[model samples]
Target chain A: MSTVEAYARRTARRGWWRDGLEAAIYLVAAVGVAFFVASGGLLATAPVDHLYGLGRVAGIVAAVLVLSQITLISRAPYVERVVGHDRAAAVHMRLGKVAFVLMLVHVGLILAMSARYDGRSILAETTALWQLGWFIPAAQAGLGLFAIVVATSLVAIRSRWRYERWHAVHLLVYAAIALVVPHQFLEGSTFRSGGAAWWFWLALWALAVGSFVAFRIVRPLWLLGRHDLRVAAVETHPDGSTSVTMRGRGLDRLGARPGQFLLWRFLDRERWTQAHPWSLSRAPRPDALRITVKPSGDASAAVRGLEVGTRVLVEGPLGVFSEVARTASGCVLVASGIGITPVRAMLDEAHPACTVVWRVRSRAEAPLLDEVEALAAERGARLVILEGPRGPGWGTAAGETLAGIVPDVAARDVYVCGPVAWADAVERDARAAGVPAGAIHRERFGW
Target chain B: MRGSRAVLVAGGCAAIVGAGWAASPKELPTLDLVAPSSPAASATPGATPSPTPTVSATAGATGASSTYDGPVVTNARGDYQARITVADGQVTDVQAVVAGTPDAQSVQINAVAIPALRDEVLAAQTWDVAAVSGASFTSPAFTESLRGAFEEAGL
Candidate 1:
């Protein structure tokens, strides 16, 4: 085998193994804290002190969970491959909520425990805790930032807030985590110098935060420096959307599969801080990558105005919506509107029995319809186009369904991308039609 | 992957709680090195003998080697125990061992303050030594721990 091909194969195998090891590491770190507490005589404590001990243990694990949230969302490549980028993000959000709740319980029970012993009211005890040191108040502020992140992320609230505003709050989680560190090292008894438990906690924090710095910070800077990526051309598609083709050297070595995405930061004087993740609208090429934007929001709308030589800083070619994720003999590519970008790209590598299902409100709304159709024909995949508004479901018409457009969709790996609700609808129908849950891949492009 | 994840999570949580029960301290634990001595332990009416004992008053040159376990004195900083060795009516040595963990700052603070405080007490040949400025609390706690040691030594 060629050296490059051999290295790719080995890397792929290691990625799968790392997923299981990641789980094992997470489990061990959390259990190690519990083990630390148990060794200190958890049950031998007065029945009343047991609550306090449990809270202390909860605090340790909650700290782990907080760090884990960062690790998962850092866009670490190995994790992205195992669960896919979208699922990693979804799990990141879910774990954030759980960690926050556990922390609240930890703080509440610890305060209550103190009150019981000090013979003071809970409120008075809380005041005492705040007075203990700068660490307690700092930790409280950290938890408060976490609350803001969780509050703004609520579905009802997130709809009203722009992605930039919500995301700005979301980024405070890093600061929240930093602010909480002193209390763990200074005040948390388990981390104090009695045993090796302190080292265990330190290692967990190092692994999680170190990965964040390496992948999110260092890797992006390296990619931007190495590739020297810039906009080679920006074309207004026949539809209202715009397509940006970026040029950089050695793009082929990026290992970006078709249907993957790049977190694109168009370094314009205006809105430079906003990064919109755009998927490849065409198969990844050797010296260039392309993304189609629909002008739907502030960031997307600004893409139409990007100068030809605009510098583009990218964090990925992330996500796993490709043929490598395929688990069936044939594949079904489903998309609506701009969602067709990934579907069009993936069609470049479609199998002989593959099928394409496109949903658009009208013919003009489909930007790359001609290219999609041509690709399908070349690969001998059936091309089914459905025009008109989506119905009660993700249907192209009032009563149309997946089985109607692609008769063998249930027998193939179905990749769906579009609006969040539309993609979810597709997944729901695919499952209802007896497709195994694992065979359906969808990316929810939401905050 | 999902099956494996489910198993890992369930087993992990079970292991945490199960190990928690297994590792907990036994009743009335031995506490070999030290325990965080409560304020109640020090404040009790007669737990400790009066500070003005005869051992410190006795004149020079006793040939016996004596070992004393000082009271585990806890302050805002944490707990500590000072082992005091006296020979020929001089305060031969004072070593303070912290009960729990001393954080980095405390470690540094105590590192400077403990030895100086010990020397001052040893030079004065008494427990009424002056406190160090940056380590006022530790100075007092160290003295208290030392006094507990002295009381055990009948001084």
Candidate 2:
């Protein structure tokens, strides 16, 4: 690489890190300001019941923001480009975590303040939750769903087959967010005064919905209209997995890398409108882009019959997982099942010191195992294939299995993609082996 | 914003302030008319024959009468007499005797109301006249009693 290219690469990497740091700072500062405003006793002096009301409203906003994040991430065609999918996912996770904490505080404060006013025991008030009004229980349900999503995403539960199931379950959070709106508007006293409070709520709702419509609906449609791409070839591996090559007029200038996914909408009359996320199995080469898909769901099933000359819509160059440079002496790339797609893509451009640990149920299920092995051999990197049923024995029983094979695993930066359970288990195992949480990165699929 | 609601709010405020300023009770007239006879003369009407009896019986009277033989005035028009008591240059009490049948409930007035009114008037206190809630008319009557006493005392 030329000196300027090298400097530009380093600068871009630093910018991503800096963005994450700045987001964290802004979140903390906003929370601090909210705390000061709440604690200043101004609300207390106001005749209206203050803290309970504020808590209720904030809870509703938090819920809405959470849903908006999910919708934006799930449906945005250019999400990877706009926020870089991996960073966007991280931001979503962090914000979701913070929102959960705030919701807990909101509920606790509301209950406490309500108890103070009505001279009722906290236990009694909680038990009377159903009687408090329909909104209370609805909000509680939303909170419950939020907690489940966070808990399931933890490093422990994420490493199993259950992770895939949980992905579908987590989508209910959008429903939960929708449920809290009426509760906020009807029960809230702040909205009644109709000043800054009214405008603030209205603006937040508008911005959130506007972001959803812009990123998910408008941007995707615009991209589809501009780039009339068609599937040039469908290459199926021995393992029944497929890579659909899409060729378009301006594929060269698109400048996407391997490991990033695109929301591909095939022009098959039955499947034209449906959009699904698929990872780029190979580096973006001249003339076409390749997206590997495993026939897992309806979207994937449609790719089975995809023919040449079939027009398709591509909304991508997403995910920051590929761009995050491996600066360590040695790196570990853990892939389970179809999670190997991004890992394979990354492996193509990876430095020589990186190791590929491919864990699959059996040798038959190991798609692209030979290609990855060839790459590992060429790069002089260790490639360990654990062929067995998905269980504790497959590096999940203890951190020692992988750590035993590669003692330097503790020191290396680890990137994992797979079923939620496997990813989670790998993360747990890595952490147990003294890997720092920041160094152990993961991207959830199907959620 | 320039609607009926705004007009209503403005009207309500104006009404409250106006009512607060104007609701104070007015000064009552003093009962200073001279009695037809002195108490000593009334105690012994047999010693002197007055032109007429000082007390007259109404339909429901229980036959209680006292004679007053001092200066007397009688006419077809309604006769009015008032008795006054004074002490230390202040009118302490006044009792009016009119020919017409007086409402029994209106015959007695609380002494405190008269004294309170007297003090308020003397001090020129014009704000928030403290009248009894249910006995509003009695406040004016009490004021009149004070006036009569003040007149008798030549204030």
The candidate scoring highest on DockQ is: 1
Off by over 4 Å in 2: A1-203, A361-364, A377-382, A388-392, A395-400, B1-155
Q: Taking the tens digit of each residue's C-alpha lDDT, what string does model 1 give over A1-447?
A: 664455456445645665564676467655766655554625333466667766876787788777777788878886777767887888777877888888899988887766665455888766666645788889989989888878878853546778887788788977888889989877775565546677777887898888889988798889888888899998998888988899998888878989989888878798568778889999988889998988887888778778888888888778878766766677788888889998888888877787788888998989787898889889898888888886778875576788877777788788998888788888899998878876788877874
Highest-lDDT candidate? 1
Q: Write the per-residue lDDT of candidate 1 for residues B59-116, one digit (tens) a residue.
A: 4365755544466555545455665667645567766645322232344456667778
Residue-wise C-alpha lDDT for candidate 2, range A1-447, written one tens digit per residue:
664456346646655554443343334333323322332212232344456546654564465555446544654543454455666676677777777787787888777765554345787666555553687678778778767767767743456544336556666766767766656655443342354545655665676667676766676667666666788898888888888888876665655676677777787888775667788877777667777778876567568788898887766666656645343446898888778888888777777778888887777878887888888887777788877655554463333366877788887778888877667778877888888765676666544
Q: How high is the lDDT of residue A422 in model 2?
A: 67
Question: Candidate 1 at A383: error in angstroms?
Answer: 1.3
Candidate 2, B1-155: lDDT as tens digits? 22554455455544543443343222222333344454532322122122333332223243332322122221211122333333343333344433211211122222333345445544542212456432343344334433443443455
True contacts kept of 1: 0.38
What are the candidates' interface root-mean-square deviations?
Answer: 8.1, 26.5
The C-alpha lDDT values of all candidates are: 0.73, 0.58
Query: Which docking category, incorrect, acceptable, medium or high, applies to candidate 2?
Result: incorrect
RMSD of each: 6.9, 21.0
